[model samples]
Target: MANTTVPEVFATETPEATVEIDAGAGKHVEPMLWGLAPYQWVSISMLVLLLFAFFGAKVHKTIAGGLDGKIAAIKQQLDEAKQLRAEAEALRKEYADKIAGAEKDAEAMLENAQHEADAILEKAEADSKAMVERRKRMAEDKIAAAEREAVEDVRNRAALAATSASRKLIGEKHDAEADKALADKVIAGI
Candidate 1:
């Protein structure tokens, strides 16, 4: 009964009497309902329902907590992945910039080498021209010296031949008295 307690019903019972319910006791006895009285059935059903509710709430709380923790972990991992991706992109950009700078430097160095080669070639050409001019002047000077020596030799030979012919003519044509007079005159002029 709603208003009765289990202890009161057992306290009023006779030890030698069979258990019986009065019509006014508000206790319904189902005939052999799985060997359980109606009150027992109600009590068992309520107890089962209560147990189910208590365990179900605990299980739900546990499942929800686990799901929340997993979600937090997943979010953290996603954030870390994003950060790593950003760093990788920055590193890639930095390397690209360095490569671009190196390429530019290489181009500049190549141009400088070409200019230096051109300058060296020009200097060599100028030096060769100067050497050629110096050689030409030396050859001309040698030729002039040989010409002067030849002219002096020819003049000396001509003067010697003229002296010899004059001596032979004077010896053949002049007498001893004329030769003596001429010698005296040549000595006076000398």
Candidate 2:
């Protein structure tokens, strides 16, 4: 026999039914199925469906597990956020209580200062009143002393004037005629 080319041998080995064209309007591809009997085609389709069902169940299980993990993580994060919020609220309450205490202390201090100021004002008023009264007593005593001194001076001057007038009257009043008349009366009476 004559030596055959590679293309001729290949075309003769695979029959036209086993190598059908799968040409389309916009695609060019070789046939995927050989020229098989009806029973052989049915058997191959059933085997491919069984394989798809097995692998589909495995893919479903994997996707469900991943979704469950994501949900658990979200729940844990929400719990942590709640805890943080609780801590913040506690801190706010603590600070508010401290501020209230400080305000109370400040109010007490202000009240104490007001009482002290009132006491100081009252003391000062009492001291000033006492000083005024003492000054008044001193002025009255000085006036009384001056009046006594003036009365004593007036009495001494009056006594000196009366003694001078009596001495002058006695010197001017005795004489000779009064002596003769007084001798006659004196002889008769003896």
Model 1, span 1-190: residue lDDT tens: 5877566343332333334556895854334355565678889999999998999899999999999999999999999999999999999999999999999999999999999999999999999999999999888888888888888888788778877887888778878999899899999999
The local distance difference test score of each candidate is 0.84, 0.77
Instruction: Give the per-residue lDDT of model 2 (tens digit) for 70-179.
Output: 99999999999999999999999999999999999999999999999999989989988988888887887788777777777677667667666665564466366765
lDDT of 2 at 155: 70
RMSD (CA, Å), candidate 2 to true, equals 14.0
Give the C-alpha lDDT of model 2: 0.77
Q: Indicate the TM-score of model 2.
A: 0.43
Give the winner by TM-score.
Answer: 1
Which 10 consecutive residues of model 1 have the lowest summed lDDT?
Answer: 9-18
